[model samples]
Target: MAVIVTGASGFIGGAIARALADRDETVYALSRTDPEIPGVNFQHWDITEAAPQAVQSLAAKATAVFHCAGISSVSADDDALYAVKVTGTRNVLDAFPKARIVHVSSTTVYSSAEPHAELWEEAGPKDPSEFTDAYSRTHALAEQLVSRIRPDAAILRPAAVYGPGETMFMPFLSKISKKGVLRLPGGGRQKLTLTHVDNVVRAALACLDVPSAAGPFNIGDPTPYRLKDAIVTHFGRMGYDQVVIEGVAKDKALVTAKLGLKVKGVFKRGDRAKLFLVQYLQSDRTYNLSRQQRVLGISTTQHLIPSRFQ
Candidate 1:
């Protein structure tokens, strides 16, 4: 059976589509731009502008759709982010009513203040009033939209995703490690959850056969880590133990305030680096993946951050 993957040009979307293709499943990859993946049918269609014909054409030949397309960066405007994450999802659902959808979401939709607490499937608070960033807010709204369309749609809320081809944090880690000065936000005690690209792809593949695997499921390595440990491990792997870990909460705030003041005229303070850091530094987000394990049959694996410290 063939599966349609949106945002196949992106990291997570590309990984999931490649995983399916590796299993000999015909993958119809839909994106605004074509990704250079072998053995997959590549199609160009913008979800924001309502690609009904494009979606329908692919849905006609596919048994399932993996809706992995959405805005993830906090640097974009709220309206543009919502259009892609919320409106784009609506268009896809409208075009493919019968196709099973695996809606890719983020664990940030959950309250980050108390991450290690209780993350119950049928329990805990659902709405996130504390989410300050446009990315998380719109993603949460998109999840609501997907649920309204298909309550049985499989929802995978992965934690901070990392692996080869990751452009966001891995590079940052490398830069800081090479400098021998890893300045952590806050006290570096914030518990963070991360999902390997391989594990996330595996979970997406498992969702294909498990019709009962509907609703939101947290997919990540069961082993949560402190932000400090993650950085230390990354540097140590590169054979560098002479690292200085500093926590300058006041300095961070001052720098953020200066940047916010400078960029206030050009961009709203909502998208400022300070605001983004507040969410990252102050919040501790984690997930209980028992539901995912029970439903998707995913076994927990070791942390993906390279273990050998220098």
Candidate 2:
């Protein structure tokens, strides 16, 4: 069976394509840029526009498709994000009407508050306020579009993903670790969850033939850690002496200045720094993956801090 993977140049998509190839499955990867990964057929197609005729032609032969392409950052252009996420999904579904789609989503679709243990698939509310960011809103819209077009599609909502090749917190952590001074946006007690790359790939593979895995499912390590603790562990593992700094009234002016300069492009002129800091420092987010474990038989065993980081 041939599999088509969108966003194959990205971290999660690339990992998924690599895993499928390792199992001897024929894999075709579609991305705007040619990825350096070997063992898969790479096709250049811009998902933002109408589905390329070449990609549409290949869709009829694809047994499965993993739609891993979407904008994840607040810095991305809003109209372009919607086009790629919402309209792009529509175009792909139109091309492959019968193909099983694994629409990779984000756990941010859930409420920012801690969810109850009973909050499983089909149990949580779909209210818009549950989502935290514009990225999540677009992802939710994309998932809804997929369901309308293909109700049998599988939805995989992973928590904040972290692993090798991760550019998000990894680089920031590296920079802070080198400086020996780590600053939390607020007091840094917010809870956070992470999905390791290996576990994410495993979850994607398990959904390939699982008959009961046709609904939305959350995927992540069940373990939750405070932002302060996670930062300390990450830096300590790198052989650095970590110092946590919380902004005080005395340092507020200096902190404000730094944030204003760093986030002027993304946020409005006045509150850019404050807005950027709150996303990392003040928010408490976590997810429940019981539905995934029960239906897909996939669970995470590794801690948030992997052995390699140690």
Candidate 3:
């Protein structure tokens, strides 16, 4: 049976597509842009649009569908995010009615408005009103769509996913690191839930074999590494042992971000640095892994650092 993977050009999606192809699965790679992997059959279709006859035909033949395509930018506006994440997801479900869907979701759907000691997969849908970011809010809305349209669908909620093709943290760290010194906020003690791209793929493929209604599972590494420690360890492995990590108080970091954001036009989302500092660096977000470990039989602890480091 064939496997359909949307957003096959993206980091996580591309990895999943490659893994499936390696296992000799007939893979249909769907994306609006260019294909990232060579072996798979590439189909051009944006999920936000109505699926054309050709796309529908392809979806119909799939045994499983991995809905990995969506706008992930924290800087994106609500309307655009909604169009792709919510409406696009609806279109995928409509096109592939018979295929077992493994919706790639985010743990950011957990409400950040209130303090939670622990985040659980069973923590029901978050109210969109609670979140100010378009990515988080729209993802919550899209989850609602999956629950209503395909309750039996397996939804994998991964924390900050990082690996070889990671476009976020590594670049940010490299850019900010000055002569072996890296600056962090909150003493870099903020706990982070990071999932390797490989683990995410395993959890996703596992979902295909389970009962269709397996619901949502929180996918994250078993070890909750402090932001600074994780990055420093990674740097050391990369032969950058001289890296000296420094941290600033969370409140001071917020002030710096606020000042940096002031001169910039608010519309363009500022720069990556501003976004990272304001939205991510100063916080702690960790999720419960018991359900995923027990249900999926896949512990994400296999690779905490990227493969290059290993």
Q: Which candidate has the top score in TM-score?
A: 3
Ranking by TM-score: 3, 1, 2
Candidate 3 residue-pair clash tally = 0
Q: Local distance difference test, per candidate? A: 0.75, 0.71, 0.78
RMSD of every prediction: 3.4, 4.2, 2.9
Give a tens-digit lDDT track for model 3, residues 105-169: 98878876443335888774588888766788888998999989988888889888877777655
Off by over 4 Å in 2: 112-133, 172-178, 235-277, 280-283, 305-310
Best of the two (1, 3) by lDDT? 3
lDDT tens digits by residue: candidate 2, 1-310: 6898998888889999999899888899988887767789998888877777888888778989999987645445668778888888887788778788898887656554443233455643256546544565677788778877888988888776777666455445455433556555555666777677787888889889585588788787767777676666655655546665564332464466466656774655443223433444445566667777888887775555646664
Where's the lowest-lDDT run of ten residues in candidate 2? 270-279
TM per candidate comes to: 0.86, 0.82, 0.89
* Tens-digit lDDT string for candidate 1 (1-310): 6799999999999998888889889898888999878988888889897775655776676789999998657667879988999899998888778888999987767654443444655432246455666777788888888888899899988877877777555455454444677666675777777787777887898899786789988888877778777766654544445567777584565576557756784764544444554445665666788887898987867554554531
Candidate 1 segments whose C-alpha is farther than 4 A from its true place: 52-54, 112-118, 122-130, 172-179, 235-243, 250-274, 305-310
Residue pairs clashing in model 2 are none
Winner on lDDT (2 vs 3): 3
